[model samples]
Target: MRTVRLPGLERPVGAIGFGCASLGSRISAAQGLDALADAHAAGVNWFDVAPAYGAGDAEAILGRFARGKRDGIYICTKVGLAPPQRNALLKQVYSMARPIVGTLTGLRRAFRRMPSTRNVSLPLTPQLITDSLHSSLQRLGTDHVDVFALHKPAHGDIGRDDIQRALQGLRQAGKVRLIGVAGDLEAAQIALANRDTYTMVQLADDPSAQPLQQLPPAGGPCYAVVTHSILGVGGTRERVLHALRMAGPAAMSEMIRLGYSPKPEQAVAELLLDRALAANANGVVLMSMFGARHRSENLRRVQGTPKPEALQWVSRLLAPVSESRE
Candidate 1:
């Protein structure tokens, strides 16, 4: 596995980290544990989880899998967005409905450039941050996380001294090794600006939505810029197919120098991972994988050479189409 050294970390971590959001929600506990073991065996040392993921089951499953192997791994979990306290029956119901809600949320964002029109008001106080991290550590069966992040926080939340102090307390107490802020572009900028407070930032990095473009040329003390959502899976395949039809195979081969795969989704995934690696040169790129095969494929693609000029050409070609609707 490829690795990058983040500031304050004792050692470098795998460039391609495992995100455990699908555990116990999309995949069975056994499958999740098996895949995790496979990843660890294959040299993937970074694991990202949150209380909000699988309604906290992902963390528990990861905890169970990580029990004996904690010494060799780097675990990252988020705070500020705790799952609702629901009964066992309700939790099961939510587990079933989570995918549907996610699909609808994606659709809404695709059309509106925003997630869920409904209001989700979470208090981002210092106490909340402190409390959330405590709960997250308990769920993950770890006394301290390598990195503790504020999940999808607002810009205002990142500027608060109380929140910063709370995170500092965690670090001082050895409950967290590094402080991180995870969210969209705005939140990232806020975190970057407050370098004294946060040492890491995690954000989505999709083809259509490149948050890297918004980052300052000289970032502050942030050592790790972790990125996720590399696979823009849903409508991306159709878009890529349409582009292939219009550009033809010859143009694509000449431009990208990479031959097209029979599976367009696999091709797209490769391109996305390449672009992500190129964009975040000094940071880790997190991808969610259910099985070993998928994880291996992703690791291979990320290790491959990327044609940034070719990707730039494609982006320029599609720029007009993107602007037309606006």
Candidate 2:
């Protein structure tokens, strides 16, 4: 695997980082650990996890797996957004409903329909940031994380002095090495503007969704530009499928005429990975792979050379579809 050095980090991390968003929720502990092991064996040293993922179970699983190799790995966990605290019964129902929704979504995809989803939001208050970081540390069994990020905060939240000070305190206390902002374009822009406070920024990147042109230039305090959603999650897949459906009987002919394959998922993955690599060539691209096959495939794609001609063709073919969704 190819590796790159971020400004604040001492060690070089793999170009493709592992994302643990689906851990303990969509996959079992054994599977998650095995995937992590596979990734490590493949030379992936960076891992990203959020407190809200798996309702606080992903961190514990990652912690258990990081026991022997904690020093070698670059772990990043978010602080702002966390699982629901109240509504125990409702939370349980939601938890149960997730897998059911995922299964149904898979079935729907088999029939060329999109699955609806919802996101749970949390306040990015100073107290919440401190409390969440402490809890994440406890769960990970680590004294400090390489990077601690604000998990999808609003643009206005980044302007708060208390939040910045809290993160500064954590760094001063040796609890976190770097502070980062992760989420949408607004949060990323806020981080770029306050480069003195935030050193890293994680945002979504894909071929059909938010392209690289939309992001701020990387430099100054914002040395690390970590990207995710390369697999076209969050409606990208649905959008692509919907576009193909709209093409009707001419979809296959159009793909062939454009010098691309007719397999939508493969095409999407290839295009997204190519775009992500090109966009963040000097940084890290985060991806989630639950099974061995997927882990290997993604590793190969990231490590392999980019196909510029194919990428250009695919980009041109998908431009109209991408623009229509905007």
Candidate 3:
């Protein structure tokens, strides 16, 4: 496993991390535990989890796996916008509201970039930040976590300053070793510039995100990079198929004709092993590995393959998209 030494945290973490988001919701407790074991045995030392992920069950399951061997792992957890309380009617309403709200918001944004359509932002107040961390610590069954990150904020939310300050306090209090942001492209660039305030930024590390290649190296306090969605949400195969079908048959055919091979999603992940090593990411967190048989194949790809030359050649083939977009 490749490793990057984060400055503020003073820990060298694996280049590939396991994200335990679907722990208790989709995968059974036994399955989740087994997956965690496999990841650990495979040299994945960094584990990322959040309360919003499986109605708090994800973190609970992670807590169980992290109990006896906390020292050997680097855990990162997030706070804000928790799962709705257990009220059947409320849960039903929430389930319905989520997709509707998202679709409507997308349509509204497409129609007009109106300020009125912005989402309500929650502030990371001193008490809220402190209390949330304490709760996460309890659930994680650990005293001090290696990194504490903030989830993506809603529109019009200016929570960065407050969240950074809260993270600083946590570092001072020895509750959190480093402060980071898990957000979109723009937010991550902003956080990267604010290295004195935030220690790391976690974001998508897809080929489309080539601009980040120019980010200044961790010169000062060493801003670590933790990437997720590197395989694209549903993994490469499914995501490319969707993009092609939705974008058009002509585009898909052009992509194929240009020498973009249709490798299984796992083969796509094999490409990332080298890229993660090259990018110096502290870790690349993947979602569940047992949700689909393809995912297990992906895990095997990450473990068995070393395809540096293939990735370089593919990057050359796709250079048009990478360069023209820039």
Give the whole-model CA lDDT for all candidates, comma-separated: 0.74, 0.76, 0.62
- On residues 219-244, what C-alpha lDDT tens digit does candidate 2 reach at each position? 44446889988767657656665665
| TM-scores for the candidates | 0.84, 0.82, 0.72
Off by over 4 Å in 1: 84-87, 94-121, 218-222, 233-237, 252-260, 304-310, 313-317, 321-326
Q: What overall lDDT, based on C-alpha atoms, would model 1 receive against the true structure?
A: 0.74
Better of 1 and 3 by lDDT: 1
Report backbone clashes per prediction. 0, 0, 0
How many clashing residue pairs, candidate 2? Answer: 0
Per-residue CA lDDT of model 1 for 48-73, tens digit only, reads 98877754578888889889888889
Q: What is the lDDT of candidate 2?
A: 0.76
Per-residue CA lDDT of model 3 for 1-326, tens digit only, reads 55556666556666567887656543567877887887788677888887766545677789899988999999888766465344344334334454453346355244223332222234667677788889889888989888887777442332456666777888888888877777777767677777766677777766545535756666666677777665543344345444444445565455456434354333334444445444443434444464445445444545533445544533543445456245
What is the lDDT ranking, best to worst?
2, 1, 3
> How much is 20 displaced in model 1, in angstroms?
1.2
RMSD for all candidates, in order, please: 4.5, 4.7, 7.1
Candidate 3 segments whose C-alpha is farther than 4 A from its true place = 84-122, 154-162, 233-265, 272-277, 280-287, 291-311, 314-326
